[model samples]
Target: MGLAVGAGAAGLAIGGGAGIAGGVALGRARERRTADAVASGDGIHQPGITTPVQDHLHFAAFDMMARTTRDDVASLLQDWTYAANRMMQGLEVSATGAVGGSPEAPPDDTGEALGLPASNLTITFGFGPSLFDERFGLAAQRPAGLERLPAFLGDDLDPERSDGDLCIQACADDPQVAVHAIRNLSRIAFGRARIRWSQLGFGRTSKTTSDQATPRNLFGFKDGTANILADDAAALDENVWVSASEGPAWLAGGSYLVARRIAMLIETWDRVRLSEQDRIVGRDKARGAPLSGGDEFTAPDFAATDGSGTPRIDARSHVRLAHPDQNGGIRILRRGYNFVDGNTDLGRLNAGLFFLSFQRSPDRYITVQRALATDAMAEYIRHVGSGLWAVPPAPAAGQSIGAGLLGA
Candidate 1:
């Protein structure tokens, strides 16, 4: 994202691209990182996780409408599943589609995405902590570590924008397609669910395959230099997917999602000295290689030193503190984005990193974040909004999205 792993999560592709999954409960994990696969996941886990990071993101959180029944919730999910599948296949949301609908009424498909290919679209659904309450009768099914994200240092979270009963992460190469997916899904929700707070992001800061090069955040530094790949089956199993031994059966093959809206102090950063900036980040801004030396992929040598006997890396540097070596070997998969919501009244750009990470558990993130409390870059950024969602495994063949947790 905009800042660094301090507001970020980690999952570096160990052997090139998305690592291969080993003892996965989800069906056969893809063996190789293809250039592209519109429907990439193997039907066991959702598509967005290991799928190649898309160019745009339309992430939304929803709260079920008041006075709705369990059946209402189930119906909404079924409707969402069917429609999401259709859109991913590059078809209309319904048979009638936008232009073919009745002239006397609104159209089934919004028509905005008509004629556009799938654009490798993926729609991932998740259940927020609030949904574990009695409204849907799903308390016992809540995974053990599923709860509101703990307060972290430098958090400026907005109450109205943080948590929700449900969340949907729609990613695609086309912004229109991504937006259309959320818009149509919201329409399908109708009176059953309404948007809480949503974020629109573009310029992906991570990649999952060898074909895609490392992308950069607004901070002018490359990210995803070592992120999980689309074909790394092993890494997916160990670092991303939740294991059966760690779960309440319903969430076994799924992973937890952490979202943070970080605001970058653009003006302040633009004024910092280049050398000081490199020291704060602990990497060569030009190559993303550690100040400790080596190429971008060279593991950082935290103990390297310079002339005059000064430490090459600052103790509080972002890379030094956030590295897995320093975090009890905990790593999270990051697929974050650099975001800019125009400018503020003071004529400064309201921009930052929209941090997104998928981990085996929420604690994985909490652990890494906790280690970054003293991050030097924390002075240049502030976490504005946050959330945690339990992403259930992909439904069985021919089943709707949440058939497991909802027990439908």
Candidate 2:
């Protein structure tokens, strides 16, 4: 019953009494527009990777059942791909959506998102390191860099929320749309796979297009002020999508995704003095400019000095340490979100950033995170849960996702 006609790139919709089953193609075309459409003529890359971050996210990880066979995984992907493609276009999981299904049977699509526009929904799939073992006979096809992420400083990762055999990231302007996506997908995988962990997030903390303003994190600083824009194809090639030469041919044009659930000690940070806060983030409190005296977009002057000859930008400051200039020009495309899962039992707010980034290789993320081992802001955040997945190229029409690896 969700809006059968998704408003396209223009971002408009006609809801209520329009009939949910017809005019589905008009919804698909308007909802997707060309910006995030399949990039290669063969549709070699997935949509959500660079499709301009949406306002809400419902990310879930899954593991295949113990007795599930290779065919099970293949069939799951085929069904999931078809459903995902349809849902992204503002259609239901199937033609017999919600109210259309037989009265005796459960609705094919959840009714929660009924009457909602597509809201620019996008579903991206990924394969985790654990899925590369003999279970599926995929060890030989595994990319060389695919492995569990090594430990880092200030980590208190929770096993209950850490790794999974697979992951799906659903993003949309409407919270209901995003959640609806994961719900239906999970329903479809019921017999073969179950959820390992999931996170619901809001208030996107980054942007993929220059037109969108940089968003703030729970810490109240502008995050990703210099994030790579979607128009910068050169930057994406250099830092994001995997290339043919990288081998494991199935992943070319695809990217590696890293998700870190960072728990912020927001109360503690709120108590810190403004000056100290600025130093920790290394940016002006109001404008997000570097301490070295420049606007938000100006290149930070790491070596500039104050009146007393002290370095204007602290070497341990987050801005200084995470800058591409200091890290061999390495950058990851961030599509993070802010999350507050209500309050903890202690009467403190349990909130933080759900950081999501895409890079050409896993090593790229490891290198950057390693460089942040001594970050000044480390005092205010804890890396509580983490995961890394190798995303495969978008499949051609009628083909299931990851057909390259499964030979489906």
Candidate 3:
């Protein structure tokens, strides 16, 4: 479970202390000038989820066209795998790229990322429940834990943005690099599949590596303070990754991904009192310390109470319900992002967290989400769009993505 060593534009060494700031600045400069850099063969096709999370994200879900056959879908995944392998190394989708193609034909690559580095670009693919339907003849191959997620209490889901037959998550340190990955993949799909909905996210809402500083959500509170880190190999294997004995063989090394688009009621939250805000989240806004705690990582003293005899961490507080203690020790790897898509019809800022989590089974999320159904924070946030996807493991050399599931 040691970290894999790789050589590519994304493989810049991140130093610590004062060097951290310098390292980031230098990394950005290198990214800008790495367009022509040749990538080493190592770590080119590693699974993105296991790799450190990137700074920006472009996540999209697509549905297959009605006339598209199962074989067509399989071929699309194979083509996507080939293209993704090159893109991750700062190369074009094909040998004859954007400007090298014939004048009468469209270029193989979309030129948006022409001069950009890989920027740690990682494109992960997943299959939705709908993909295993009758159209694909894949129902019997579906994993036992890959069923559709149940509706929660406060959900106000938008149908168009909810479910999909397939999903692709492209993340990178550079925003344009992430966008370009998705754009070309969608282009490659062409008539076989079309985008159902997509989300663009800037600053990360959670940190996956120990070296990274905790990022803040749109709610202005530090998010994922107790999140599972990539270095926690034991926890990752037990909670995040699906084992061969856990379910269907096709999904042995896979994981379930749950995405919830939680929209914050910004105007209303802005007007709320600071103390009330702290009470709602059960943590100090400035320090991220628990109400009955010592520091940011201090375990909450849920049993401690004030002289008034009330629980220090309120029963309905978010931290209390979402805590692993309350959810049978279940934890999911959160890799969320903060998003703002202009103003709403009422002219208020439309902003919130694009909450994403990966787990061995969807039940981990379902259990915790049901617990938070009555959380005080639910009053300030609305669950708008949602999706559950079964993410397959990374492909080996000479294999296509999801080769096991598609029998490729």
TM-score of each: 0.89, 0.91, 0.90
lDDT of 1 by residue, 7-73 (tens): 0112222122221111101112212111111222345667677777889999999999999988877
Expressed as tens digits, the lDDT of each residue in 247-285 for candidate 3 is 887677678999999999999999999989989999989
Candidate 2: clashing pairs of residues: 8-30, 8-31
Highest lDDT against the true fold, candidate: 2
lDDT score of model 1? Answer: 0.78
The stretch of ten residues in a row with the least summed lDDT in candidate 2 is 17-26
What is the alpha-carbon lDDT for the whole of candidate 3? 0.78
Backbone clashes in model 2: 2
**Candidate achieving the largest TM-score:** 2
Give the distance in Å from residue 82's predicted Cα in candidate 3 to where it truly belongs: 0.8
What order do candidates take by lDDT, descending? 2, 1, 3
| Model 2 score (lDDT) | 0.81
How far does residue 112 in candidate 2 sit from its true spot (Å)?
1.5
